[model samples]
Target chain A: MTETRLTEKTAGIRDVAARAGVSQTTVSHVLNATPHTRVSEETAARVRVAAEELGYRPNRLARGLRTQASEMIGLLTEEIATTPHAGRIILGAQEEASRHNLTLAIINSELNPDPEVPPVQVQAFLDRQVDGIIYATVYHDEIVAPENLSARPAVLIGARDSSGILPAVLPDERAGAVAVVEMLVARGHRRIAFAASAEDVPATRGRLGGYLEAMAAAGLPTEGLVAEGSSDARGGYTATNALLDAGPTALFCYNDRMAMGAYRAAGECGLSIPGDLSVVGFDDQAPIPESLFPPLTTVALPHYEMGAWAVDALYAVVSGSGERATSFAPTLLPCPLVERESVAAPRA
Target chain B: MTETRLTEKTAGIRDVAARAGVSQTTVSHVLNATPHTRVSEETAARVRVAAEELGYRPNRLARGLRTQASEMIGLLTEEIATTPHAGRIILGAQEEASRHNLTLAIINSELNPDPEVPPVQVQAFLDRQVDGIIYATVYHDEIVAPENLSARPAVLIGARDSSGILPAVLPDERAGAVAVVEMLVARGHRRIAFAASAEDVPATRGRLGGYLEAMAAAGLPTEGLVAEGSSDARGGYTATNALLDAGPTALFCYNDRMAMGAYRAAGECGLSIPGDLSVVGFDDQAPIPESLFPPLTTVALPHYEMGAWAVDALYAVVSGSGERATSFAPTLLPCPLVERESVAAPRA
Candidate 1:
């Protein structure tokens, strides 16, 4: 395709008016796609042609009032910096937003909200006049709408309750955990330990429940194998050490960060991954899995894909097409085990 | 602070003018902060008060033309999906831009730039009217500037050689490399290996130079240990295996991705980190130290700080306060060794 010489600096509506032998106001009305115009269709088309030839791009924001649409969505992510899964979510949301030619105005609150603290900084989105809002929760919790947020259409990501007040998209945490356990059992691993975080968050409970359900269904012992740790590596290290003391051959981690901590503790305890203690991790968004000591045997959750699905759900709501909760599903992507150096036959 | 009751409606310049008892032209001049206006100080204060009270936000792009400033910076990231470090850069730039009340327009090319692409499509930023541009390259290469980009003030990040044309802010690759090697050597490591991508690139060359310099200073042999690898975990793994074959007690990787590869190789070969082989990596931005089995002992480059600095440099140029390159010491931020489980005393 021959490159069009559309210079950054272009003549305004006055230039178009002069070329078309019409008033500047007439040219602007045609350019703005104004309603209730007395001008004939043929005349409007001529003005549009002249403006296009001049490469006069209309300012969408300025014309938003006329169109009642800015074609922009505001994404408010809580604790983007700290959340390990947020990167993929943002990436997915951006891709979907761009695909639709809609701009995403993203704002992240790194601070995790205390119960007493205000839930969100909704004012930013309000000020921007965003067409819709996607509120991605840092941790799954009871849906608490900050007072007076009902004016705009909004969607929630990772909400514990979907009362259908607004549409919500979340990962099927229970199914993900069950899949991880089933994979290890299928691999002939009898002794399986569940390493969970100390935080009593909804997502953690769901994951823990899944682990127990899987063990019960498989007719295996769940006692003495479940250990609690912090959300970070140090927590994983301590939990792994305790789990090892009880002599579990296979360890299932709640998340990638905890898995890393388990890796460190195993190293210190002289237990080789797969060879000694086969490790399986959830939320395979971490960059270290490919390079982990025994490239980790992880059950990868499609975090980015989930985010993309959320975007699609939000788009449906904003476009007035897809039904509220009907369009949104708690997407349960099957967690697949990434077979690497992490799993091997149990040491004799 | 009492939450301000937001009145949900579009408040325009005309509303502010009527409330202030001033002309629309006077309100525009006052909002633009335009000089050469003989409006009384009291009148100007009244206009400002009216604008604030009525919530009259100026249309940025149109006013940008009148003032010849957008108060916005355009950030061109090399890739947003793969390189996690680029996200940090975006965050830093966005934070700095927001602090200065400047909006940030980000465009990410996943590094697949085809020369055949038209200038208008490639330069999606042209319509945005950004006052300054920060071109953040994930890898070092000659950027094919958009036709007539020289007219716009820009700063390149992650690569120097602005080709004596535009300003640049780059991480001191040589210094970063030297620092990692020095840390490994201080821990009584002698046979240290340097693993990097194909050494033709500027970053690879600079890092290689530092490795050689450090080896010479330490009076250690540089033969057979320096190996070329890809810039990802697989490359790091292959290069590390080669380095191990060459019998290096310690390893210095080009970046975290490469270091991750080394970590995997070391695990596969039954080598415990720090005990069997000490490993150090670069660019501690993402899930490197925390995600690695033993939190990696690697260099943490200021990717976000560089982004902030790049914006500051561009601001200086746009504001016409400082020279093209505010300074050229390359901001020698010593990538301090984060002593995790990765590095240990070389086995005697």
Candidate 2:
């Protein structure tokens, strides 16, 4: 009711503990929801009453130190400013961060110019004093380390060949690619072509390699298969048109964009998806599989798990209870072919 | 080279300053390129020599507070989980962040869901102690204050009505839509249709409103215009297909994904871009515009400036040099019609 009430100074947690004649530890236990700790009901009620009256705010920094825990984690995204799927990764990371009572501070390593720890950035983290670091690359490659992160625990998301040095979480990329190719083959398409951009990026390479491996592993002809496609829908469209010239019955795309391109090109060529030419995509991103007149059946990366595992690893370090570098076996969460109106038996 | 050597504790700036018999201030001045502060040639040389010998790593946080003046800005993204253009916003923010010698720490508000200030996330910033906060919302709205942030300086990015308390940097939605419409109109398209998501989102509403304004302003018929698209590519595609049935010769999509949908539907309808139907899009999102067979002609948001400006505005408050709640007129950076194979004159 009073104007001064709006600007009154709030009391600290220490004040409440002092007023209730309880230790700061007890107040923290009550606030943090630490179960199994017993306190008399009357005493708890008294403490709550005092805290409510005083409007005491907790100093998380000091509390975190006492608990030997920091409810904060670092999320380092690779190719953040460039990749389309980066949004999904951040979303998954946020979901995981919420579930674990951890907050994330994101850094775009893409702009660092240097692959290793840019000195300036390292100091920035030091100033903020993050509990753990999660280095995420767009797709995955062997992520190189920056200088001086030994004191702080860290985790890697995406493709980093960890020889058991630090914890890493990567997608079942090879399996995803294989699933797409196998689906195309099941549709009775013999001459399947691959469309992808930049053969150098790990995910691109992995998908392409998986296609080849799946084809060869299945004894399908490797001749005249695979086209170097760009990482966008337009590139996919162009590449599909080019591959069609070679008389391929079906196509496996690197990512969703290229698959969208193939959808357009196929439509332009008057070829029915899965009826004349079956199309499969990797990295089931937005709109492509769902927005396409026929929903796309593409490989879905375990983005959510990658974020969750990375945080778990970080927390393990904070608790000093987990393996230093835990390597999670890539779990393929089925990129099973979603049969829509898209695929029909390929016309001979 | 011994592997153990890499683990040696690196010398800090203070160590170098002590060794050089110089004040930390002089060392900072030498490193930061400040002109007004004077140091003798001999003293400068000695300080440099000492710094080099000790392999001094400057404390970026401390140095930033002094001579460097925190080029680092905080880009506080709202709910990184569900936003469409947040990654692009981050990209623009990063580009601007680096251009200004400022680094960005993107924090997700979703991690903490406090009505006043979510319980989990605020501590992440407090520990890091970022110089300024840039509150970036995917859609514009009033900002709910995070607890204990009254002392912190911050700017609102992408909020239209900021309640006259926070400096806001948002996309000039109307101008952007106008630019897209103008490009289509200039290319000789008359029957233009608009595809947008829900009107609840400020961005979508502004862009859709801009499209209508541009249409009426250009004396074009607003009949049969569609604004029932979602913010995804599939939504764009479906909306575009429906609009095509209305016999529109050109389409101005809400975002790139919608344009992408148009591309697919166009293919399905055996229509050639620019030849049969022309399309324009907003947001030059990656893999969408570039991956398109003929790269998309779309309006791009000044994502980085949004971030950089937010930081600058926040700094104005932190430095106690500016008024609270400054407003940045949403800028329209001339969405230069990226003359691609998308749009052309209506078929003769």
| Model 1 chain A lDDT-worst window of ten | A1-10
- Please provide, for model 2 over A1-348, each residue's C-alpha lDDT reduced to its tens digit, 9 standing for 90 to 100: 223323654477788999988987787777666799987778788788888888665644455545434465667676776665667666666666666666666666654455565545444454445678777776546655565444467767775644446666677677778876777777677787888675577777677778889999888886767677667776787788778888887777887778887887887778877777777777767545666667776777767667777777778766567655544453233344445556666786
lDDT of 1 by residue, A17-109 (tens): 888878988998887677887787888888988888887765444455355665667677776766666767777877787676665656666
List DockQ for all candidates: 0.28, 0.31
Cand. 2 TM to true fold: 0.79
TM-score of each: 0.80, 0.79
Model 1 TM-score, 2 decimals: 0.80
Which candidate leads the pack in lDDT?
A: 1
lDDT of 2: 0.68
Q: Which candidate wins on TM-score? A: 1
